[model samples]
Target: MISPLGQSFRVSKVFKRCPLEIQGFVFSADLIELSFRKFNLILGMAWLVEHQVGLDCVSKRVTLKVGDGEEVVMVGERRDYLSIVISTMVAEKLVQKGCDAYLAYVHDTSAVSSTAEGIRSVKDFSNAFPEELSGLPPDREVEANIDDDPNRAEFWLENTIRVFDELSCTPEECMKCVVSLLRDSTYQWWNTFVSVIPKERITWEFFQEEFRKKNINQRFINQKRKEFLELKQGRMIVTEYEREFVRFSKYAWECVSTEAIMCKRFKDGLNEDIRLFVGILELKEFIMLVERACKDEELAKQKRKAMIEARDTRKRPMSKSFQPQSKRSKETNLRMTISSEYSH
Candidate 1:
């Protein structure tokens, strides 16, 4: 596959042309090295094993455990994708040093891991190797449309947090990763934010604490706070209302950051009837507020059903002579009335 920076390569034909000699020895996909220069030949797993080349990923260093020691080789990467590419001279150096190191190591029969034929300093390059190599397993938005969707903005934050949590990285590293993934308008917005923030090397914890005071991102929170206040439990089920309340509350931290304020804000958003039924006096805590909202929602539903039944009873024809205007008249009338009233 090609790298993210568009450094494309194709070498399948080589193996196709000499399958018997090259099939298990090497293949095209093995050329995805962090090369530093152009190469006349691309080396594969066979060459690596033969040279006892070992990759040290964490330090970004390539090591060849030849003889009694190893050397670190620096392979430069493409800036766009961070994929490595190196020059032909570097490749030759790698191969030459690797041969010397491994030949020295393998020539000693007691090296245990490798057995080059005839043990004593092998001259040929083809047979001084091992058999196997192990496996290698490898949004945006906001301010403008961010105002239009505080919910979506919060979603992006939560998603980014989850990505970082999975990595167990520091908050700074997490934010950096998230920023790097942004593109287009979102990228531009973040870049502007980066530029505006004081140019100092600060930990994420410090920046997160100070960002609000230093940035214009308060609009999102203001929007959410407005939504939170405007929320109504009127037609929404208790569960749905709870979700809305929580979603809006995420952005409106100042208004509902405390237990009393949150409960009050939540209670105030409920439909008047449910709020009255649940009784603000009874909700001393956030949990109580949620439970009563749910209870009141069910109470409201039962009340509605009883009212409908009572209205039906009142509208029904009492006399047999008055009952036969139409077979579907009563049910049809009730359906029409309900639809007319709630269509808004």
Candidate 2:
């Protein structure tokens, strides 16, 4: 047998047609014994072809067609495949050389969900897996091949950060995911940037700062800050205006450093009718101010609707038969009808 690095080893024995079951699908395969310790078993090309297997390297999953014509999928455990062990002497040398070390506890929970004791254990230690990390990541996008537009860069950075926050990912995990998602010029830039920096110091914050320095311009940020200062609710509804306000507030943090300043700034930008009612309350909380503004806007809308209804009622013409006519007016109408009939 030939190894991946082209080293040759003699096969000790071949076990033919050994039954193997994966995910409830049974198959027979030929197993060969070799002098290799890295893996317990490796499927050969002949077995893969015989089973009509399909492999997705990106997702690390395999699909196999069974005898009954049903396909079964098997997901790979990435950590198992990538794990490595080091001797105590090698570890000591690395420690002496000032190498950073991180320890991760990986629990095998494949059978935990089906067992009673495992269920109780999970309930007792529920904090181990946070609820936020259970679901899929957020749907926000960071373009793989982004341009030099500062707005797009800022959006990408913010969106990446938001996704990391939602997933409760650590700095190391964030860096790994971000590096994987980068492509084209951005990927090249990352490669060059990381070449000189030590791996231990290349944190998420450091990456963000370097990325902003390369992609975002100070002039664009200043412009956005100015826009935030000049922002007004205008024709936007309370909810929409509030969304924009929050989106721009980050650009001008100093202006809204305090809760009172934020509330006051938001109130001052509201429409006149809503501002009149909301401003008088002098609410300190930003959330309360927003709620009050929404309520006042609703009230104003109802008042306008009521006025419109009343005006329409007044302007509506009375029925012709219900109108009171003078005798002279009735006589003139009767004469005109009689004259029209005689002419016809």
Candidate 3:
């Protein structure tokens, strides 16, 4: 279909003149099987149709109806895929604009029943539309080559890599350290992202409208639930795994951000020693802290257990002493019963 953005066919234009290909002015029939492989690029067209026609679900047809009751019906299978694609495209834009894409997608569900059919949340759309946004330029393009100062850069990097190789740390620990460094570098990029969001410009209603066009939140919830089940199957609680997952997720975000910001500066002329020193310092510090904390917690738990055992040992002797008191009470009761019988 033509969108106002000129990305696709305009309904008015198409409707006005029935092409020979469409056969007898039946645009409603020809819309089927017309797929935009990169649907995100034509998001403007999808939005225009979603707003004007609205979605109507009948027993026989899943229809996208424009003004004047022009409708496009499709096979049930195609309807699902098309709806998911359209919804995801709309959701991604709302998310890019810093709106609450998930909530917006929820409202879109009622407006277009099939919009949220295959999708559940903004995150879902993110997964579905990963290639939609080209995002920022590559880090390498932004910075000069590290090898521009070949000898100095190589020598410094060699030492850093050698030291890392000589260390007895496991691969997991090393990865964590590297990730921490990446995150530290990208903090500025995150701030930049926040700064760009026009808080005042994006209203809740606008977000809701966009969200309804694509069900993002439901997809997110469903994905999380699936993850929880997998964790449970592995004898772990979803909540516990989620904590670790969140930590790594933050680290991943930071890594991308840091690389984008520092690569240019590092390439420009920064000394290798300074870069290596800064990168390694925070990771080393974090490892030391984590190790110390783990040791202390273990020591505290052992000490608590020993104390509990000692208290139980002392109580055992006291319990034995109470055994004699019970025996004496039993004897005294027998004597009192005998005396009462004699008096009677």
Candidate 4:
């Protein structure tokens, strides 16, 4: 599939289906999801040039009866196949996956012991994640990310899927059995309020569909990203500004795809003095920028304090050294002054 940025990635392996053989014709069954948001499965008609597969036009249906077995009746308008499409996220994900595949292919001849191996057996999977619920502590909420960590969600996703694969259950089962592990209000809200499903129709795909319908919203994510982009420290203290930036980090995935971009965006939203201070430093990492901003602000505060103290010292009156008069001398002076006043 081609991404929006003109990048291409492979999704599936090229494989021929086990066909239903007739006098010389063959057919393969296909499972297709009937959604406008879906991509079309390809079928080759080169073989049909010699052997014809009859098509029925009525009832907006097509029938291919090349086989002696039961004819295939496809419920769709008959037209030549045109094109396929994929979502932008899906395309990018595929491209990322393809990179790994390309690397493996290029290094196919490398010794296994030379490379890092992470594969584990099914026993390991079963041991680590038994097909049971792992309840959470009370009031705990499983957030998308944790404590300003950008990789938290990705880490969670990797482990969650590994456990899910080990369980070998439907998504509903996974959700239900997993409920014991979470006592958070968010999880409870999802379990008690959002998890309404017809028992007969419960499936992993349906669960994902409902989950996205109830939880994930692209427009909401986009709005949060916009807020992150426009955020400024303004008059807020360092800690407050950092908190706000961290709070909205998860939504702005694209903005932080690279450390350079993250650094630039974060630098743009900083206060002028902080920006100038941070700019002078060779900071490339987001964490480094946060640390430096905090450090610089503190230094600025100390400098201002020192300047104030110096100004205050300069404003004060200076005291000069003076000798104390003897008691007898003071008394004599006082007596002379009193007598002079009386004579006057």
Candidate 5:
């Protein structure tokens, strides 16, 4: 019988028709709310089973007791197997959630530690839990902590198994007791959720290379390597233009060094060649050329502006004036265009 507060059940049975043998059953109950979108009316069951004997003697069976005292048979493993049953409705829901739900139980026949060490023992599994859940109460507490963190259920269940192991219950025994808490239907739903949930970025290849290096300064080296890889991915490397700029900058420094060499050689000159070099135009000549070019450009600009103004003025074209010679230079007339109405 199931307790009102929800507890696990233990049972043992022997069939008279089969070869004489003993078997144990561990059962628990759990409830799951439906999304109400599909309204699937299917029913199902799941079983978790484990066997530790050399010949593999563990087994789990599930049968649905339907209305009118009838029984519905489901397909699954027979002997030395762990299995879970899921209705069509539940399977669809799990498919939607992106996970598979299964019920499995471990069996232990080890006389050394009994079922406590085999199933519910904390040492049997690794706890890959975050730091947030470390300080919470045990899963078996009368009430869950106020945090109500989404991952609490899994943490609580795993922690409870560890506690059970300390209390002398085997892992197999604890699994049997908690098997029903996980339904095949809900398992599928959880799987789907996990698949679609956003995950933090993780690139293992770079990390692995750093992790394998053998050195006393591995941590610092790995950190630097990680930063470099990130920078590469972010495209912080130099471009063609930047590379050219750096090359030219180095050449400019070389020019300064050459100038220093020239000055020293000039001071040591003892021949006509050195005297001739001193007379040649140097840095000051370059500056004079630049100033001349600038003055020429400014003068050209002023001449162009004056011509434009003269052409645009409201005045007649200038007539050619002839100088009369002493005896009968004929008076000459020149054609001129006149526009007295010009705006300027």
Candidate 6:
């Protein structure tokens, strides 16, 4: 006998005229012994034709016409069973027999639901999972080369750590998620790293230290620290300067250790004009110092605008109608005197 998947199976034995009872109605059918596991018995077309049986798949009903000319309708029962896993061999056999086969992917939701209700639930799963982590990470071209820009590597590490902290991920979970995010050369590098280091000795901290040592070298860090120390506002606006100050401040942590020191360092970088106004306030808080500096810049702009307006007013020519009467009369008399002298 050919199975659904086109596999040949030998029928062991066949029984002719085996009486089968359906809804208290007796019918004769030929039963065959087969190795198929999906069904206990399958009725052949010849049996259905001889019995004048009609099947309504939509309604799940069967109509049987007996030899006594009596018609009986049998209603099908609905049964819900958990999915079964079958081997490839069995699947092929079923497909060969012309059975409609469908493949379904199932996920265990109970475990996820239970984890969500637990106290340590946040540490168990990533915020990206089940949705954002549904498929493999997309293959995108690397825009910035990690070798040239060590800061990019540091930024990615810092951002990943921040996300892990927000999700309350444990060290082990962090290790797993961090590896998944790595791609291309980075992933290959990780594989090489793990091969050298014993898995038992590797912790999240150890991984981080090694990663920083390899990607972000001591020379790069020293350069960044120097840049931070020499950073000045110069032509940059207060907001732009503040952004750069915050960005580079991490490398030189000793310089701006406290709020007072941070504020002072930031204030020292401002332009001379703005410093003259903000320095007098001596604000200790960093945020307040920035706000005061911005306010002072705006006030300075307004003052400069007012002064320019005043200067322009003094330089502007006055109309004859608006001029003082004494000044106008002196001019008119001078013109008449000049005209009379010319005539003489």
Weakest 10 consecutive residues of candidate 2 by summed lDDT: 115-124
Candidate 3 residue-wise lDDT, 16-100, digit = tens: 2222222123332213333346552222355446534344454334445444766555434443557775676676555445464
- Of 4 and 5, which scores higher on lDDT? 4
- Tens-place lDDT digits, model 5, residues 39-105: 3321223312212212223333345443466543334465422223325445645543546445476
Candidate number that wins on lDDT, 4 or 6: 6
Task: Evaluate model 2: give its TM-score.
Answer: 0.53
TM-score of each: 0.42, 0.53, 0.20, 0.37, 0.13, 0.52
Alpha-carbon shift of residue 341 in model 1 (angstroms) = 55
Put down candidate 2 lDDT per residue, 1-344, tens digits, no spaces: 66554335577688998889787767888888876566678898988998899999888889998776889998887635534533544664564455756558787878545643333433455567778455444343444456467887888888999898755466777888899878789999999989999988899899899998888878888888998999999999999999999999998999899999999999999999999999788998998999899999999999999999998777666555477889999999999999999999
- By the TM-score metric, which is better: model 2 or model 4? 2
Candidate 2 stretches greater than 4 Å from native: 1-144, 318-344
Error at 23, model 3, angstroms: 96
Mark the regions of model 1 whose C-alpha exceeds 4 Å error after superposition: 1-154, 172-176, 185-202, 206-216, 314-344
lDDT of 1 at 154: 56
Model 4 poorest ten-residue lDDT run: 145-154
Query: Which stretches in model 3 have alpha-carbon errors above 4 Å?
Result: 1-247, 251-284, 324-344
Q: What does candidate 6's lDDT look like per residue over 1-344, in tens digits?
A: 87555545577698988989877888888899987677678888888888888999777788999767889898777633212524655665554455655548798877655432344442355564767555554333445545456989998999999998755466876898888888777878888989988889888898799889879999999999999999999889899999999999999999999999999899999999999999998999988999999999999889999999998887676554476669888999999999999999
- lDDT of every model, 2 decimals: 0.60, 0.82, 0.42, 0.62, 0.37, 0.81
Cα deviation of 209, candidate 4, in Å: 6.2
